[model samples]
Target: MIPIPRTLGLTPEQVDDLLTTADRAPSRHDNRPWRFHVTSRVIELYSVPERALPVADPDGREQRMACGAALFNLRLALHGHHVRPTVTFFPDRSRPGLLAVIRHGGTREPTPEQTRLLLAIPAQRFDRRPSGATAVPRNEQHGLRRAALDEGAWLHVVHDRPERALLRTLVLRAERLQTADPAFRAELATWSARSGGVPDCLPAGADGQESIEEEPLMALLTSHLTGTVAEIQVGQALQRVLLTATAAGLATTLLRQVVEVPHTREELRRLFSAARPPQAVLRIGWPGAGTPRHGGDVMTTATVP
Candidate 1:
């Protein structure tokens, strides 16, 4: 463990709390392919390739996206502690494993926006409705899109009836391919199936079902380019959008089934943007009365560097 220092007004207990919050970010097949190297002054995030789902995520886009989400939580936690964090994505060209280097800067009080967004972190859940779709207020939808832009990513809302129809067809086909693959289903089942009190995987009760109901505001998050660094930025944008939506009393779930397939992803790229690469698609709407928030953490794969 890295010795927790009193710098930046953060106590050891606060640092531990930050780590706990970051560990809850979602991942592919619940394989949290992220590790942290922390010190009093800095926190570094890295990807653990061993934890990746090669067949389902052959290009490792989801892997980097997972690390990006973790990085966002770390920054938010530090911000809440009144510590200014200087972040550099892909700071070291020589060390590709080091996705980000977040240095703790001077102490200052968090802004109202920061506080509200931070509060929404724990409420962001993988919501799945058995039937029917709920609608979100138009203003709230704009706020969610703004959150992504602030993080240097794009959220393309698919609303046209024709586009929604195309998306449904593409998602159904991709999901069929994934569900038919023995290895993919085996891996998903292994991580998602919980027997004890373990909470490292997807919610224990979730039946890994794709939503075939009427579409709500389906948005795709895209980056300027499709690369390792770009994917990390996309992840940060994704979390920001999801948290902002949750703060606005909306339930959000990632639509990975559509974007996981390479060919389908190409189709999405053409639909959303020919220039930018789509990293994730999110389903946004009003949740049921008292929908449960998602919360989980992974076993520490590596520690302080």
Candidate 2:
């Protein structure tokens, strides 16, 4: 077992509150594939394999990455409470499910950087419509790229029409293929809210045909394919881009339809040879004028074990 910090001041209830709020960070499919172990002073984030999406994410890459984003949020939540957390990732190889162990290192005022990121959390939503606005401002784009870099990932904006068109076509093809496949369609349909559905299945709002239709751009986030470690890094990078977008008062929605197809995956790899292999695609923009505020709650609360 990992040693716990000795000087924690927050009660177990407070820690639970922080963890619940932090885990509200967006994830693919609302999988919520995370377990928390809260001691007197530290919180450990572990992966819950049962929540993994085997069909779409066979290797559990997206699940782990989503947890990494939660870990980042946990750090931010601690900052909001005026505590500086010391974080360790993958602390024990024997326990591969352990994603992070965060301890209350000491007290410090929230830094300017932390404050900016925290301020952006609530405003960020996954906008699934064509942004009425033009291109994102250059400075904001630069900031987004930097955010990914800081998290050990790179962000490439496809500016040229040819590249963008290729990505768009690939996405459309993947969407068609997934819709056509009986098995894939069955899985998707099962997740939908029928007259009656499994409590653990995908929520109604999360499984609409229109979710992927609103965004056209197919921006990819890639990582080297040699090892699981790279995939985890890519997930963290994806989260950084997301939070940064939120901070800028922008909206983001990931397009998993393209990456779900093996053929399209290969095509995207061929298209973006210089960047790492594409792990996921995201479309970012300002929310539409009449877009409803309701996108469904992606948050859950649990006792720390």
Candidate 3:
């Protein structure tokens, strides 16, 4: 295990890099809702309440998941600095918005994997229409699964045919369900209209990509617990998985809506036999342009190493 330092301080360059890396996290509709507060003591993670998407993410589950991704990036940025960070999740029980507090720990050299992952941060993104026909190698899939375990989550690759069929049906149902709602479309369009995806906008033809029929290797990231703590870990697991995939020459996008609707989510959970509901579902494959919608199940799902 990496040791943690008691106190932490950051130079202007480190702080800038840290915040920059944190900002690169993928948010729903590209509405990045995470913020960072830096002190000589520790760095705190915050959620921008005003950035909440009501119609789609009514309870702020995805929003917090985005914040968790931001938090994971920040942790990696610190790791790049060669110092273990001691993190306090939901540091202030009274303040739910404060997601995590990270303090510098022991001095340790960054691992080769950590170094490579940090560099891949800028290249990592939600590739909507990535070419999924090409398969991901077994080694990389294991690494992706391990990344989730390294953090506090499980990566379940959807493999059963019945489950895959159910997932596709449920995903399509979610798209129709969301499309039928006028408010959902308006909100989605509003985000899409934003200039250059500024402030907020539908990313990579949002809603459109969700309908992609091609099923990729679907990896479901689930937390051991429920509520804030689990969601936060889910985000971290997500980034780790994404970065690992990116590093392995694989591309990804979130299969969000399937897990968004309550009934569909329960069905997805039952499909995987997951003890707790998953935080996010990932569609992974070779990188390509014209991204697809929250892509489908693990067509060639592999067990974690």
Candidate 3 segments exceeding 4 Å error: 1-7, 130-132, 195-216, 289-305
**Worst 10-residue stretch by lDDT in candidate 1?**
296-305
**Residue range with the least summed lDDT across 10 consecutive positions in model 3:** 296-305
Model 2 regions more than 4 Å off: 1-7, 194-218, 224-226, 291-305
lDDT tens readout by residue for model 2, 1-305: 45433335776566766767677766654557878787655678899987766766677776777777777777787888899988777889999888878877889999887787776565554444455354667887888788878877777777666777677677777777877778766655554444134232111134323333333333566664436556666766777777777666665666676766788888888888844457777766555566543332221111010
Off by over 4 Å in 1: 1-9, 130-134, 194-213, 289-305
Would you estimate the TM-scores of all the predictions? 0.84, 0.80, 0.84
lDDT of each: 0.71, 0.65, 0.72
Model 3 per-residue lDDT tens digits across residues 139-249? 878898899999889998876666666777777777677778899888777766652443231122344344244545767889988997788788888888887877676
Give the Å error, residue 176, model 3: 0.7
Compared to the true structure, candidate 1 yields what TM-score? 0.84
Task: Assess candidate 3 and give its lDDT.
Answer: 0.72
Candidate 3: RMSD to truth: 6.9
Error of 1 at 229 (Å): 1.3
Residue pairs in candidate 2 whose N, alpha carbon or C atoms collide under 3 angstroms:
none
In angstroms, the error of model 2 at 154 is: 0.6
